[model samples]
Target chain A: MEKTNIRTNKNFNKVSDIIESLTINTNPDSVAVLEEIGTNSSIDEVRELTSRALVKRNEHDSLQVVISNRGKGINDMSTIVAMSTINELLSLENKEEAMRVLENTISSEGFDEEVKENARSVKALMALS
Target chain B: MSAIEKVNQLSHRIFNTSKNEQSTSRTSNPFAASNFQKNILTEDVFESSKSKEANKVNFTGNLSASSKRIYSVFVGSINDIGSRISSGIESIKAFGSRMKEGIVNTCVNTWNKIHEIGNKEESLNGTKELLGRDITTFFVNKREREISKMANMNPHMEVKSIFKDALQALEADMVQVA
Candidate 1:
């Protein structure tokens, strides 16, 4: 188990380096790397970056689907990431599902108080809009 | 029975009762009476050191790794934008008064876009407005100084315009992920 942990850490580090390099180079390949990390990596920051990068690259539709699918079980930090990603969705009609996810996160005990609070606030903003 | 007989019987019972064959076992401390003790007298064997790998704690879980990577990339991207802005300003500085009007127009337009995208109420009541103002002021002052250094009296309008331009560029260049 310990060895597995060590190996996993190494893999994360390697992937992280690759992603950073792609981003730094502004290579189109970075989008694929980001997408992979966003979907597969358990890390929220990595996912956030992937989502943001995807949005910037005009991959909004796919990003929305990804967020809808994987944006569950959000804790406080993941809530922030999820909210930020959701905000970038661009399409108001499509945002309802993502917003619902945030609403669920607000009620979820796994998230920290701040995340829940932010989720609540984002939900409120949605209600107002 | 008579008292004297009772007394005699009690004495006999007390004195002649058979002792239990099983005796209570005695225990000894191993440290106190070990037969094969080491001759060397040092506390090094008892002293402990933490492993390096153990000390290097891995931030495992969702928030830990994700937040860290996101933060790093975010900061890096910001720096990249800042450098780009600084370089633009430097080039404008070289162009002197000729670029002043263009710079201000650009900054003001950028500010308007930022205001539009961000909630108007928040832009007015929030830090964004203050930040936008400060940024505008900074570029205005910077451009004014550079123009003065060239011994050129750039019109006040031109200075304001250029400052606005720079501020707009700054806002546009800043990745609005949220």
Candidate 2:
């Protein structure tokens, strides 16, 4: 029975390793593993861990910008990049620079009233600093 | 009927039967429904307590009324400081560049004067020293304070309490789940 338990544990470890590798290489497989793990683990635990991971990733990106831009003697360039990157991260609803880019794209063409109203709402929902 | 629709109908009947059985069991045991209701009430109480705690920390009412006012003033102040610092740096650079030009001009004038006196080498050395000092001063003080202030403002701790409270709430949620 102990040997059987050992075997089962090894199988579980193998599955977990496969899942981890899949998370980097295959989007659908990663989602499947995430779902499986989410069902097996506590749902809130998964969400909290994911949230922390996202925050850490954002911090890492910000730090990378600072480190790379240091000693360049170009303050304005560094300041603008840092501010824009932070604003992008802190802007919750827009997800990416999509809303800003979309607004610019739409406005370059003459504004239709309907499109303008939609853009306005989107901007409000996804306001950046 | 489609296969999916037929399967759904069958599932619905099964669900109804299970629900009926549950209701019959509840009717038979008076304590069961009361216990279930008690659990529901407890859950609602917990949720309300959590919400109240969140609201207290958030300063929700004060925030709604005065946040915009405070932020606009804060931003305006920062902008004013920033512009002043930028202008000051620019002015300093201009002044330094001008001073360097002035020194060179003065050297040229002195060189002409000393050449008349047959002392050209002495005047040339003096001009070099003057230009070097001016350039050093120019580069040394370029927006130093402004850059320091900007760096200080990064990773602001103003909303740290809110983040702490959020983390605390998450921990509490994890504990409850466990």
Candidate 3:
């Protein structure tokens, strides 16, 4: 598990570098360039870049979808990520469904013990309602 | 009872008895040996050099007190803006209703005045007095239409100003955060 974490970290760092390079080289203001990059890049590369950038932006965002997904040192990083996730979820009309997704994500075994415990407390409080 | 259940009950009773004794002891002499040990362990741990170093490291991380203050400020400002915008909308709605009522009242008063004048005198010197009433009514209608149009556009203008202010506030906040 530790080895896999190190590997993921390295991969994320590499992808981050690639994204920074892309951002520097490409015109961010131009939707055409973004669309072109999306179309031209290999499916795996695009997915990896998008996923890693999102993770870099907020690790808990990816975790909210899959409960058991573990990243050791990402708890502090989760707040901004969680806020962004909540913001996105709020944008959708089906807010209750979005909240359910958030709940399920946090409940998953992939989350750290503290996060899981917090989620459990929240669930308990919600159940009281 | 089963052996384990009997043992559990006995242990629980013993624990409860000891806890009661400890509480009684605390009231008499709070700085007793057990209390001293508990205080030393909890308090001294926080005051220790190792704990201080750990805290220093934690403080440098994203969830530091300063970062938390910034996040709190952000959330607070957003909430304030949301509230102000909503209240502004409500105020505009209230203004619209009041304006509508005012226009209706004016129209009703003008009609009453015209009816009273027409009843009082059947004819004027040369031209019909109803023509003057019609011209006044036309001007009132035009003015009401203009007021309605302005009222309809006012919300959009206010919305634009609110958005502009919000963007400015956000930019200033970002600069502060940076």
Native interface contacts kept by each candidate, as a fraction: 0.00, 0.00, 0.00
TM-score: the better of candidates 2 and 3: 3
- CA lDDT of each candidate? 0.50, 0.43, 0.45
> How do the residues A6-64 of candidate 2 rate in per-residue lDDT, one tens digit apiece?
23343333333332232232223333233333223322332222222222233333222
Give me the runs in candidate 2 sitting further than 4 Å from their true place. Answer: A1-129, B1-62, B81-89, B92-100, B107-178
Q: Candidates 1 and 3: which is better by TM-score? A: 1
TM for every model, in the order presented, reads: 0.22, 0.17, 0.18
TM-score of 2: 0.17
Q: For residues B27-102, what per-residue lDDT tens digits would candidate 3 score against the true structure?
A: 4333332555355222222245666687787644658788889988998999999999999999999999899989
Q: For model 2, what is the alpha-carbon lDDT of residue B74?
A: 90
Residue B116, model 1: Cα distance from true site in angstroms: 51
Ranking by TM-score: 1, 3, 2
Off by over 4 Å in 1: A1-32, A72-77, A90-129, B1-178
Clashing pairs in 2: none
Pick the winner on lDDT between candidates 1 and 3. Answer: 1
Q: With candidate 3 superimposed using the best TM-score fit, by how many Å does residue B69's alpha carbon deviate from the native?
A: 99
In angstroms and one decimal each, the interface RMSD of every candidate reads 20.3, 18.8, 19.8
